[model samples]
Target: MTKVLLVEDDATIRVAVVRALGQRGHAVATAPDALTGLQLAVSERPEIVLLDLGLPDLDGREALRMLRAVSAVPVIVVTAAGAESDMVRALDAGADDYIVKPFGADQLDARIRAVLRRLGSETAAGPIVVGGLVVDARARQASVDGRRLELTPREFDLLHYLAQRPDQVVSKADLLTHVWQIPYARADKTVDVHLSWLRRKLGETALEPRYLHTVRRVGVRLSAPEALGTSPEQGTAA
Candidate 1:
């Protein structure tokens, strides 16, 4: 079941949303304010965050900024703020999706599912070939120079996702939901941990990476060293 962190000060709204999400087979954790939400986000590491803008202690936008500073978790701003400026500000602040107040539970659920599906489909389209490395999406496997790499299921999925979209940055939040099947509010360190393992297995390093390129404050891109103006022989999987 997907874990969700529901951050809302309103007791009624929190209870209703928690119940609705629970009925949908999700594990819901509620936080009464931005501080508590942030704490829960770090500790529980939910799959998604449903944040309300009007909080008693910290403003939602500030909380969002703080959260984004440490985590690449997918956050959906659920609030009464429907102004164009508000939406734009939230997006600029790193929100993945937004839902206005008075929205139906079904609509919220659909949006959540849509976000997850989009992430999942990002690498679902085709096989990727980068020099000696070949990633097959259909089989969810990877090989370099005709030698198969032993990967955990999560590693295979993560590598396949990156390879499928070579050169394009894939956000850590997207990777969490799409690959790990966990909520975005979880620690981005999880991605880092897995990526470190992936790099080691692939015989790569961050400073002189052979396959993975981390885009600062954005995400990661999988490409050949040639793509980075180095050499095609040093291409790496995403």
Candidate 2:
């Protein structure tokens, strides 16, 4: 059974979700406002959080930023706003995933399971070293050139997944399946957004990558700096 915190201002939606999750053998805790939810997030320590943006006391985005400041608990933004910009903004603010409102219980449960699976499966016997980047799966930490990278759980998962298979060009479809634990959708920009964030944390960009290299239509590959030639684009498929 998963422990879930549902933070929704709408009483009807909150009760319905709680009931649905309970029926699915999940233990859910509900809060009517963002503040209470934040308190429960830290105090109750649920494995996952389903947060709504239309809160009475605080905006969910602000709440997400605050929660990220104190904890790295996985958050899925459940909002009525289906706009792509809103989804990207929530993701940028540190959401692990985003689910539009009016979604079915089965879909929600699937997302929860995916997130938990990704989190639980990231353990390795020791740190994975690629060039100057060190990804310690056991400790769930990563560093570049002796400088630590403050990655979100999702970001770490993405990097670790690639580090485990260095130099192999992994298609976004495969990445969505193995790393995100979701079916591939051509329009989904989830991988791109996370990759951008990961690049930033690694002190590089797609244009001048040090560890991660884009293989054009193929996908992304992680390689030691020595593996590539003088140009970042060299040794990588164009």
Candidate 3:
């Protein structure tokens, strides 16, 4: 059974969803406002969160941003806002999934299961090691050459994904779909920006990469220094 936190201000919707999810063998906690929800999220630490955008106390997007700051817990936006722009905004704000309101319990269940599956699949295989870089999936931590790399939740997720497939070229499209939980589209520089941040933290740059190598007009590859025709002792680029 999944532990779920439902953050919705509407009494009717909250009560109905609590009952519905309970019947599905889920243990659920309810919060009527963004502040209460944030507190419950930190203290209770549910497996997943079903958040509504129309909170009485705070805008759901702001709440989502705040929650992302403290936790990497999966969150699905369950709101009445069906606009594509709203969906994009929430996803960019770090929501794991998005479901328009007026949804049935079964649909919600499916989305929950799907998101869990996608995120859980990689971590289940345990830690991934490529050269001196170690990515501990279960621990949600990473280190390069025995030095821990301080990374944001999104950065860790991206690194973990690429580390799991070392030497395999991964397109930005795949990274968007998997890492960011969004589909690929032109003019999206999100992946590029995050990769730049990750590179800096890894003590490297795009022009002089050590672990993350860019394949022009193709994608990016995470491989050992030796695999990239560089000496393992070469160390991080300045």
Best by lDDT: 3
Tens digit per residue, CA lDDT, model 3, 1-238: 9999999999999899989888988999999999999999999999999999999889999999899888878999999998767876787687889899799999998998898887798678888899999998657689999999887767888898899889898888898787766665543677788888999999988668888887766678899887787533333221
Off by over 4 Å in 3: 81-89, 230-238
lDDT of candidate 2 over 1-238, digit per residue (tens): 8999999999899889999999999999999999999999999999999999999999999999899888778888999998766865777676878899899999999989987776566653578889899998756689999999998766887898899999888888887766654444453678888888888888887668888888766788889988886644443322
Cα-lDDT of candidate 2: 0.84
TM-score of each prediction: 0.54, 0.78, 0.84
18-99 per-residue lDDT for model 1 (tens digits): 8898888888999999999999999998878999989999989999988876665578899998875686567546577788
Q: What is the lDDT of residue 52 in candidate 1?
A: 93
lDDT of residue 3 for candidate 1: 84
The total of clashing pairs for model 3 equals 0
Off by over 4 Å in 2: 124-127, 136-140, 151-158, 172-209, 229-238
Q: Which model is ahead, 1 or 3, in terms of lDDT?
A: 3
Q: On a 0 to 100 scale, what is the lDDT of residue 222 in model 1?
A: 85
Q: How accurate is candidate 1 locally (lDDT)?
A: 0.78
Candidates, ranked, lDDT: 3, 2, 1
For model 1, the superposed segments whose C-alpha errors exceed 4 Å read 123-238
